[model samples]
Target: MSDVDAVRLDLNNPVFQRDLHGLQKVERHAALDTLAKLRQPNWQQVYRDKGLHWEKIVSIKPPPGIAALCSVRITQTRRAVAYRDGAFIRLLAIPSDHDATYGKK
Candidate 1:
C-alpha cells in the first residue's frame, strides 16, 4: 500500500512516551514489536486484524482536539489508549492496568 493508505504510528505524546519508557523490559520489547507490525498494515487491515483488538473507548472523555478515544492490544497483556488522526494512529497512553486504559477506576 502507498504511504497514504498505510497506517502511521505517532509516539510523540508525553503520556505515551512516559508510560512506554516505564515499561518492564519484556513488555517494552513486545510493545515495540507490535508497533512495528502496526506500521505494515493499511487502516482497513488494522481494523480487521483480530489480534490488535481495536475498539472505541466510550467510558471516558477525550481530550481537546481529539474526536474519540480508542484502544488496541499493544502487547499480550497491555492495551493502549489512542485515536486516529488522519492516517496517523496517535497513541496517547499505555496505562499499567487494562481497565485503566479505558480510564476506569
Candidate 2:
C-alpha cells in the first residue's frame, strides 16, 4: 500500500483508548468501516455519502499544545479526529457528539 493508505494510532494515547472504548456497537462498526476505506490508496475518491465526510476541525481552537486537527465522519453523530503525521493520519479521538470532537482550547 502507498503512504496515503496508512492510518496509525498513538496506541499509547489514553484519550484515544478511552474514546474508542466508549463507542457503541453500531458506532464502532461504522468507525472501523471508515478506517478500512481510509486504508485504501484511493480513499479520497471514496463516497462521503457512504460515510466519510472528512473535513478539518475549524470552529474550535485546538487544546493547548496541539498544532492542528482534522476529523472524518464515522456515522451521522460520530467523528474520528486526527492530525497529520508524515504520510499517516494519526487518529486522536472518536467523539460521539459533534461539538466534543472540535475540542476546547
Candidate 3:
C-alpha cells in the first residue's frame, strides 16, 4: 500500500500484540518509542543503525512463505523478530532475552 520506501511497522500480529502487552510499562514505552524512530527511516538507514542491530536469523530456519526472518533491537535490552513484507516490518515476537530472539527453536 505504500509507494515510498520508508520503513513501516506491522504491530497487528496477534503474537506481537500479546508480547508487547506482556512487557512492563516502561519497557513497552521504550519499544513504542523505538518503533516510532524506526518508522522514520528507510530500510537502508535501519540496517545501518547500530542500536537497532538489524540482523537476519541464521540460527533458526524461517517459517514457510517468508524470505527471511530478522531481528531488531526494540528496546534497550529487548530484540524483536520480524520479517519484511513489502515496506512493512511485520514484528512477530519480543523474546524475553537476547538469545531467544534468534536462538534455535
Candidate 4:
C-alpha cells in the first residue's frame, strides 16, 4: 500500500506463511495495524530496527537475474514471513528456526 513494490511472500518457506496466516485468524487487524503505523512519513526510522528478536525486518530486493527469497521478521514477536517476488509467485511461511541464528534478541 505504500507503493514500495508489493510485499513479497516466499512460498518455499511454509512456516513463515503459516504463522502469518494464523495471525489472520487471531486478529486480522494485528499485522495490518502494525504495518500501517510503520507506513507513515519517516516510518522506516521508527521501525528500522525495532523488531523483537536479535534481528530486524530487513528491506531486500532481488539482485539482477537472481530470484529473491522470502524473508520476514515479526515486528511484534519476532515471527517470520517467507515470500518471493514476481507474478504467479510462491509465497509461504518460514519457521523461526531459519532465523534462529540471525536475530536472537
The TM-scores of all predictions, comma-separated, are 0.93, 0.69, 0.91, 0.34
* Candidate that scores best on lDDT: 1
Model 3, runs deviating above 4 Å: none
Name every residue pair that clashes in candidate 2.
none
What local distance difference test score does each model get? 0.91, 0.67, 0.89, 0.40
Off by over 4 Å in 2: 1-12, 42-50, 62-67
Checking candidate 3 for backbone clashes, the offending pairs are none
Q: Of 1 and 2, which scores higher on lDDT?
A: 1
User: 100, model 4: CA deviation in Å?
Assistant: 4.0
lDDT of 2 by residue, 1-105 (tens): 655564543444678778877888887777777667675444455324355766778876766766668887766677878765555667777775777887753
Candidate 4 error regions (>4 Å): 1-19, 47-75, 81-105
Q: Which candidate leads in TM-score?
A: 1
Instruction: Give per-residue CA lDDT, model 4, range 19-95, as digits (tens).
Output: 65666443435555544543334323433535422132344443365455433344444444433333222334434
Error in Å for residue 48 of model 2: 7.6
Cand. 2 Cα-lDDT? 0.67
Name the runs in model 1 displaced over 4 angstroms: none
Q: Output the worst ten-in-a-row residue range by lDDT, candidate 2.
A: 40-49
lDDT of 4 at 37: 41
- Candidate 1, residues 24-58: lDDT per residue as tens digits? 99999999998987885688888888989989999
User: Model 2 RMSD to the real structure?
Assistant: 3.6
